[model samples]
Target chain A: MLRNISVEINGKRILDNVSFEPNRGINVILGPNGSGKTTLLRVIIGMVKKTEGKVSLKGKISYVPAEFFSAQMKVSDVMLAGSRIELNEYTKVMKKMEIQGLINRDFSTLSSGEKRLVLIVKSLVEGDVVLMDEPLGNLDLANRAKVLRILKEYDKTFIITSHEIEVLDFASKVLLLKNGKVLYSGNPADVNESLLSELYNVKLRRGKDGWSNFRFDF
Target chain B: MKGINLIFLSLLIISFFLSLVYGQVYVPFDKIFSLHGVYKTVILDIKFPTTLSTLLIGICLSISGAIMQLLLRNPLMDPYISGTASGGAFGAVLAYYLLAFNLPFSWIIYISPVIAFMFSLIATGLTVLIGRKTGVYGIIVGGVVISYIFSSLITVMITEMSIRFPQVPPLIFWLLGSIQIVGYTDVVILSLLALGLVLVSLRYSRKIDLVSISDEMAYSKRIDPNKFRVFWIALVSVIVGYVVSQVGIIGFIGIIVPHILRRFYGGNTKSLILGSITLGSTILLFSNLIADGSLGFEIPITAITSLIASPIIIYVLVRRNAQEY
Candidate 1:
């Protein structure tokens, strides 16, 4: 939960007066690039110092960075980092993620999507509250769906930031942010085309699957 | 022990005995322990301390090197990369200068390591302060700059000394690194100190692993990255200062042993430090064997290590870059 969270770095405000109470499900933060989405996540986990704010989260928190600089360690070693899980528990988690065979492989040699999944599994096993930054960034369509499915059934607090609007379909609560200000904080279904259009600075239409950027006017 | 570690240990044992037997006077294996007079003096008094000091220094530098890499978050980093060796060398050279010219602080020659230790801390502290704002690359650049400045100053002082006292041999040979001149008292003291530092470092291995990932990761794990960085860096400076004060800057052993063994031993700090103990000593003992007038004259130990390490470092760099593509 965040209240009056504002972050200013080098005399430039990165996050203005922002606030939201996230529930025990996927609370998706929708925003354009540099709209302070990542900064908001970092502030919550105390990675970026909030200029002024009240951040209160009840539970252990783990973070999956947007770009994981994989250490020259094994996948299993990376997974068990800062976690009290046993090898069998790690194996079970890895099995669920379909990365059991990669337990012995060098983490650096894994593909980007595999690495992202590994970190996700790591965060999931390590914390009751997981803050993921662009977790679906490097994942392919199938892996994205796989990850989203796993997250939806995990029964924990997930504060995920994504530029991809498709995740909007699964979000229990949505916080629409534009230029560091929260424009909407309610049900995901309440997020409309016009507000999203304003948020991205372009005219958009909601298609059967998700929102799409169209240039028919041009 | 693992395969690599066992191999290294065996190599160390072999090299240890060989060094004892093949010094200035070839006291064969039979005479090394049982003989009296010159053979006993050479093996027990002269060669034992020299070889023991060399082994101890290797362990200290190698562990320090691995810790330096973790603290800096740069695999290429070594104990000397932060200017400690050059700073310690500067202090040693200054001590010699003062003694040679009967300067005000001429008595410092008796307790030169204290001066060297102080200078080493100052140099590394300056590097840390200069680079604190800019992160990894800044610290590396700052270290290089500090190292160069101290090295230049040492060269100037040595040059002046050479001009004034041409009959005395130059300190350049020692600066290049040699274990041939260490006495029993220094060896015993260094062994105890190095042993304590190594044990302390091993205890922090798990924390070092977490910190090496990233500061945010370290913070998430409830470990303060900045605090650990300072503690480890200070510890490494002490290790380097002691080694340099006793035997000058050995060079490359710190970088080379860790860089090489990390392949066979893996990147876990505990295992790497453990493996480094054996392998680092093995490499140095062999180098000392070749440098200890075995081929009729002495060679600086750094020369041998540089000859071995430079190519391996280049190969690793090239291979890493190639892998990235």
Candidate 2:
């Protein structure tokens, strides 16, 4: 239960007067670029100190950073790190993520999508209260769907930040952040396309398939 | 597993005997059977104790370097980099200048190392306390600052003491490190200390491995980085304190020996600890031999090692820079 966190960086307020109560499901944070998404994740994991508010949480909190591949290590080595899961469990997770082939490869040698899958699996093997920063980025559609399926099956509290509209489908609650402030907090289905388009000042044209034009408006 | 361990054990024995044999005056193997009175005394009293001290110092310093590098997660790190050697030097110099009561020879020899060890440990404690707020960089900076302060004090003490004592030149030679014969009692004590350190290091091998990955990763594993770091800093201080007390400031073995072994053995602590002990002992023995035997001059053991290690350090820097760009 991570809550009541406020963080500021370089004299700029990144998370301003924010309070969150997370239940046992995926809570997705949807925001545009520079919306304090990564900063909030860092604060939650106690990586970056909170300047103005307290971040209180119980149990283990595992964070999968966006640049996980920046470390020079073997893929299997990184997966085994900080995770108490058995080797068989790790291998099972790798197979489920469709990355069993990457087990022996160097992490730096893996493709971006493959590295993202490995990082996600590593975090999953750790204890509950998983906080991921853009877990689906650089992943292809198939791998993204595989990860979403795993997230749905796992019984743990998850707070994830992503800009992809497809990821919001898995969110039990979507917190809309604008300019480092919470603009809307409710169920994902309640966030109408027009409101999301209006929040970023972009035109939302509804097509037969879905809403398009993801580029933020000026 | 047994076979590998046996090989190292045999190598240690051979190296010990070779270290005793290869010195300024070669003691012939046949002379052991002849048993000349003075020859037996020279071999037993002088060369044997010196050989044992070299082995102990080598094992202690190398293990200290390996553990410090793992804790800091920086390849270039060593025990001396954190000001332990300078602090020890300061204590030794202070005792010489302030407490020149013309005590017994045994008192001067034994008490100096203990005083030096205590001073280095205090400096280590202070560094860890002040650096807690600033993180890793703070520790590095604090170490450098403390090193400078202690080094200045040593210089002042040396200048004042030299006027009164005519044997101050030999003391300076001792400061630069020499593998001259130590007493049998000192050898036994140093060996016991080294054995204790190796056991403690093995117990914490897993934690050391986790630290090498990254600090945040260690914390996520429920190992508080600060607490573990403090423990490691103390362990390293004791190792450095003991070795520097025995052999003054033998540079490069602590830094280069571990890295060179890491190239063959991976970064795992189990292999690293073992390899460092073997390789470090061999290098020290060889260096001491060159300083005393073939060189035919009273060359400082530290000078010989620096001559070998400086080029390797430069090569590592250039290679790292090339990789970075």
Candidate 3:
């Protein structure tokens, strides 16, 4: 939980007076680049200490950052680096993510998408409230679907940041952030076109893509 | 691999045996056991002390290197690379010039080690300060720059000392590097500390693995990277300081030994530490063997190791395309 949390770095406000109480489901923080989506997630996990506000976490926080790279290590060791997780359950998680085959492979040897999946798998089972930053950026069509499946089936709370509007379909609660401020923080179904246009500085309307239509205003 | 351990131990034992009898005169292998003749005099008096000291120095340097790799989260971190040894060397030489150079050299021995230890501690402080700013790649640059400065200072002092007494050539051994010891006490004390520190280091193997992956990962596990770093940094300082003061600065063992071992063994911190102690001791012992093998003309152990390691490092870089760092 946070109340008026603000983060100012070198006189530039990265997060300005942001307040929110995240619920136990998919809470997506949506914004374009440089809008402080990453910073907000970092601030929640104590990675970026806030300059002003009262912030207190009620549960343990784990992170799966957008960037994925590690020093020389096997995939299994990478997952178990922080502390030992229950092996039986961890193996199940890896299998579900379709990464059980790469268990003993070197982490540095993995492709970007593979690295992202491994990081997500590690984060998914690590903490009470996992915070993911751009968790689906490098994933392919199949892997992205695999991620959505996992998120939908997961019983724990996850706060994720994504620029992909398609993610809103699965996001129960969406926070529209713009210019370091929260433009809208409520159910994703209630998000309006005017609010999105104002947030992204572009007009948004219903557009068709293949079999499905999405909010697309190019 | 259990086989690797057997190989290292076998090599260590062979090196010890060879070191015991390969000095000025070959004391026959059979003469090693009977403590009664010239064999006893040579073996018990000189060879035994020097060989044991070399092994101890090897363990300390190797383990220090391994911990440094984890602490700095950079494969390049080592006592020599980060200038901790250089700082200690400068301190030792400076103390010798000021406190004991005029007196019989034995008189200054007491003060040099203490001052060297203190200076090495300061070097670690500087390394940590610079490392935090530079990240992984820049930390090596920072350490190398700092050490170069210290090395120049030592050179100037050495040149001045040569002008005064004309007998400072021996001191150059410290600059280039050596496991050459002046006394047995330094080795004994260093070995004890090394043993304790190695055990303590093994305890943090899990946390170190996390810390090495990413600071954020470590934070998630409730382990503060900075706190773990501070503790290990202090450990490396004390270990490096004591070793440098005792045996001068033996470079590359910490960087090269663990890296080579990591290829054969895994990259986990526990395996790295264990492999380092075993292989580290064996490599130094073998180097010392080669150095001592030249009949009637002994060479500095530092020169031998550099000659051996420089080629291996170059080979690694060329083969791996410089990805290990």
Candidate 4:
């Protein structure tokens, strides 16, 4: 939960008096590029200093950063670098993800989606409240589905940020952001076509099936 | 314990023995035990201490390199690159003039290592201070500039010293670096200091591993990377200072030993540091052997290290290029 959070970098306000409370389940922050989604996540994790705000977080917080690159290390070593869990527990979690084979592979050898998934797995095993920034970014359709399934099954608080509108389907609560300010925060089911069209600055039509579509044919 | 470490250990041992025997006058291993003359004195008193000094210096430098690399998060970092070696060299040369001129500060000037350590620490402090806001790449560039500044100062002082005392022969050879210990006392002091520092570094190996990757990652994990980096910078400065005070600035061993060992260790700071210890000593011992044996006369140890390590470093850079997209 944040109370009037304001973040400024180099005299430019990146987050302007933002305030929102995440739900107990998966709470997703939906925004387009340059909408300060990553900054808000970083501020929560204490990676970025907030100029003025109060951040109240319960329990241990683990984070999956949007961009990560490591030394030429084994995947197991990368996962266990500063992990809070034991090896057996970590192994069990990896088994649940069905990515046990990835443990022996070099971290740099993995594809982008696999790397993100591995980091997600690392955070899942580590934190009570996991904060992920653009977790589904750069992922293909199949890999995106794989991650969505894992997040759905995991019984924990996840504060996830995404530019893609598809993430709203599984999100219990949604915070709509535009130009570094919160536009709306409530149940995702309450969100409508006009609000998203304003948020993305593109005409989005809510079809009869309750899925949104861009006005353009593409 | 492992294959690579065991191989390096064996090589270190063999080179140790070989360095003892293959000096100016070849004293065979068996002959030294029974001979009770100049040969015995040469092996026991002169060659033995010098060999130990080289080994200790090697340990100091390679460990310094490993620490710098981890602290800066750059694999190419070394004491030489961070201005520590040139700073120590400048301090060592400054001591000569301080004594010759009979300066007011008597205590520190009397001991070269004390003054050398002081200057090296100051150099590192200045480098970090200047580069504080600029990040890692800035610190590296600052170090290079500082190194050149010290090198120029050393040249100016040496020239002034020569002009003042016409009888004094040029100490140009010292700039090239050599294992020139005063006696066994130098070896003993260096051994205790190097061993203690290396042991202390081993205790922080886990912390080093955590902080070496990225500052944000370390901060997220609740490790203070800045504190660790400062501790390591001071540690490397002291190690480099003392080593250079004993043996004039030897290069390449610090950079080469850790780079070669990293292929096997792969981001394991403990294993990389431990391997650097043995591998550094082995490579330096062999360099010392070539310095004393192959040329039929004593040559600067740096000459051989540069010759051998340049190709290895070039190969590493080329391989890195090949692998990158």
Name the candidate that leads on lDDT: 1
Candidate 1 wrong stretches, greater than 4 Å: A209-218, B95-111, B125-145, B162-169, B181-183
Model 3 residue B102 CA deviation in Å: 8.0
Off by over 4 Å in 3: A206-216, B100-111, B124-137, B163-169, B293-296, B315-325
True contacts kept of 3: 0.51
| Model 1 global lDDT (CA atoms, 0 to 1) | 0.79
- Which CAPRI quality tier does the interface of model 3 achieve? medium
Question: What does candidate 2 score on TM?
Answer: 0.80
Residue B308 accuracy (lDDT) in model 1: 84
Per-residue lDDT of model 2, residues B235-292, tens digit only: 6666676666666667667777777765555455666678767777877887888887
Question: How would the docking of model 4 be graded?
Answer: acceptable
Write down the lDDT that model 2 would get. Answer: 0.71
TM-score per model over all chains? 0.90, 0.80, 0.91, 0.88
Q: Tens digits of per-residue lDDT for model 4 on A72-94?
A: 56677777766546766777878
lDDT of 2 by residue, A1-218 (tens): 43455677778888876666666778888888988777777766556688766667666777666653233346666666545467678789888877788887755456778877877887787758888888889988777778888999999888888877766667887788788787787777777767788666676544444433244334
Candidate 4 segments whose C-alpha is farther than 4 A from its true place: A83-85, A206-218, B32-35, B104-115, B118-143, B165-174
Q: List the residue pairs that clash in candidate 2.
A: none
Candidate 1 C-alpha lDDT tens digits along A43-82: 8767789989899999888878886455666676676555
Give the proportion of true interface contacts each model preserves, from 0 to 1. 0.22, 0.11, 0.51, 0.25
Q: Pick the candidate with the highest DockQ.
A: 3
- TM-score chain B for all models: 0.90, 0.85, 0.88, 0.89
What is the per-residue lDDT of model 3 for residues A41-147, given as tens digits with 9 covering 90 to 100? 87876778899987777677888877644566777777777666775667789999888998888776787899889888888888778888898898888998889
Better of 2 and 4 by TM-score: 4
